[model samples]
Target: MTGERRRLRFRRFATRLERALDGGGAVRRRRRPGVCAALDRCGLSAYYVPAEYGGELTDYTELHQALRMVARRDPGVALAHGRTFHAVAPVWVSDDAVAAHRVGRLVVGGTRIASSLAVPGMGPEPHTGVSAYPVVGGYRVDGEEWVGDDLAPGSYVSLLSRTSPVATPRAHSLLLLRPDSLPGRGGPSGSRRLAFCDTRVGADALVGGEGRGAEIVLKARQLGWAAGSALPLGAAEHALRERLAGSRPPQTRRFAEAYADLLLCEALSLVAVRSVHLLPGELSVTSAVVGLLVPELTGAAALAEDAHLCREVLAAQFRSLVRGHRSPHDHRPQLDRLFGAAEAVVPFAPERIGLFSRHGSAVLGTLPLSVRRLRHLARAAPEFGVAAGHAERLLEVTDTLHQRLPGPAVTGDPGLGRGYALCFAGAVCAGLWLGGGPAVGDGPDGLWRDGLWLEACLTRVLAHLGVRPPSGADGALFDRLATVMIRQYEDGRPFSLLPFPMAEGEPR
Candidate 1:
């Protein structure tokens, strides 16, 4: 990183985090909405827009830093900003039209609510956009998307449709419209379907073109993946600071590993960002999605527990602030649920990671853990061995890697903390898998080694959690990951050699 870049990062932090130091009593309590809006008005909302569109032209690093800063002070704001970023992503990836139609629309705030695939129980549809849809002119939109979240009530919405679905619609279309526009027909409609946890925000509108909605939405979700890393990364950082500030407690090992979780989050976050640009092959989207969701609580619980352990430490006010800031799942603002959203997205959430590590060994499903497979398994063969066999394979491969790999160095590595967290995070994934959550879904493609780092981290983290890899879960998880790595990296050939890494003194 350059000196200027470092300073710029600090400046960005200062700009977004001015709220942290404003008042007293856990800055989360008694927030000043006016301050938040003012900051957004000042340029916070346009952080990712290009210079031509009146944004800071913020790069990936700045966006990451800004998310951390905002999340650190108030995750609520961070989440809201995330939604906006998602709202605008279509423009960023909207081919040529991205600049003129979609990007230009958000630059001046012409739309209202933004809903991506996360919108209540939605699923992905195969690509279906025509280069020139509906042959008419301008933009015409139809169909209704479910709306929830606080933005629902009476907010306008920005939707993306497969351009080809409606001819005359331009490619990479971005549609901007109002909820009221659905006068029983035309120009995009709405329905009461999935409810988003983040519902505090007010109002909704539209952005860019209509008809060509899906492309914009897809681009946004893709770009939004990088930002997704920010959510848990910030939580992990705060957890570490909270634990370090406490008087040593019984949870020391878990605390330290949790501290490491933040580093892993950052490393993984960077990798995810690169994946956005580099476009890795054989990528598993849901696997990637769940990968980010799982480690969130590994760091979160460590922070919450340590804070409760030493509530007297006045310096650890962020803990209280964290408690005060409403999460995506907080049904009531006053009785806010801690790490609610983070918890829902993954199984074995909160202290479940530690609990499961102790007794419950997780086994993931092999028949693709998508909505379709889940439904099929649930309805057809409820007693299928989908989870157990997969679990055994993971454990087998993991042990092989441990035997083959060099002993991990324990000194002077900048990412040492990350190394530790990956072990636990991996273990946590295993636990989640046992609980019917799928982990390590990427089938032999695109930096599986990075995922291995996470699994390796889980091994160490499980020990810190006082978990003995109960029964056969540990061994099973190992085999699955090792087999995955070999099959993915070894050119899809059967492994004549054992699935192991190179030992320090072993001949190649």
Candidate 2:
């Protein structure tokens, strides 16, 4: 499914999603039951379960359609929903399978909803009955954690603590508690009072084992992350399609670069989503290894790709249209934020750049010398925003790993060269998300051009790497993809590629 055919097929789904989104179906989940019951008529409930469980599940193509539709309404909402979509995995892994089955039955019955598990501080806290420890039977489960707004009545809540068991001390375990177990125990008497604001649910509470809470939490977060990661990709795709459909051809290269990002993210999401079904423990931990490496790799690429897209859009139309119309009149202060949006990204975001390189080196380093050789060198690459001196220092460590390891070596003359290409692919996708736009038939132009343009650039950049072909038709696919993205970039309406403003008064 590459090139024009892929686009043709997807375009229809995207259009369908757009209609659903515009019809307010995008956020039907959080609304009143009657509203959602209407959406269910549209057959969206199929999206809620695994294919094995009578749901269409997260089919890459379908997800792309669904998310693009929802995101056009609100990226934040799409993000929030995505994070909670697969909220069932942690419970499925419960040591107390009986309880897991009970919870499953509730969900199947539409009488329940569940928030994902998260390290306590990572998520909001609730008012009452949080268990205290791996207490009498389980770890002390005395505490309260908030069920995010996405949670409806009868929805389950998950939390994580930093306890380690004596058996597998190196790793963490899981615990499950249901909504019924409220006010199970209060904090210290003198400490403080736990209050419930608008908190209401049934009573037979409890989920996983007490001490194993952390495991479920981590799994939930990963599930959430995988789901969240897909959104930007979908949105980026939507943006590219919308931009390319317009009259003008893009003058810049960023659109294509962003497209590459969309493609890469879709692939990563496919893999990450599959990783969700794994039983807990070693394989799950390995999946985490994949999780840590993903964002940093593709996330960086996405940012870079989007930055380029924004640059293209702003340069072409935004500077004149958006800036000219608003800047001169300058009546509404809010409009100013749009132009100022493209503030510079500081030299290499070390956290961003180092993520893949460091994580890959940490996990993959244990492999054969040949594998380690090529893999480690990537962490050391110089980033656009990174300081050269520091990048150089980092390079030293990477260099040592590359040089010391000896295994599969690309011959100097071997057509394919050496570099961290996968990570680079990840960066390309991330770049598209930030600046991409709406899907076609959804409405007017979106930042789609930027996605397409960025897609073009990423392809060009990746092409420079040794063209070691991918498994199947993927080789020809990337090649053709590069062309599509470039075309999209060359032919779309422009917008400023501004990073989302973190606070009020900041650029948009």
Against the true structure, whose TM-score is highest?
1
TM-score of each model, paired residue for residue: 0.48, 0.47
Candidate 1 on 274-356: residue-level lDDT in tens?
33323222112321332433344444432221121111111112222223221232222110111111121111111111100
Question: Quick one: best lDDT, which candidate?
Answer: 1
All models, RMSD in angstroms: 20.4, 18.1
lDDT of each: 0.38, 0.36
Q: Residue-wise lDDT of candidate 2 within 1-508, one digit each (tens)?
A: 3345544544554444444444543343444444344334444444544444444443333443455345434455455444335455555444455655565555444543445223322122211234343334334443454444344534454444334334332233343344444453321122122323333332223456435454444444444444445555534544555565552655333444445545444444533443232211112222333343334334434323222222221122211222222233323222111111122111111111110111122112211222233234334542211112222333343344244223243222112211332332333233223212222211122223323333333343344342322344234434444465453334431122221111111000
What are the per-model numbers of colliding residue pairs? 58, 82
How much is the lDDT of residue 487 in candidate 1?
A: 38
* lDDT against true structure, model 2: 0.36
User: On a 0 to 100 scale, what is the lDDT of residue 433 in model 1?
Assistant: 28
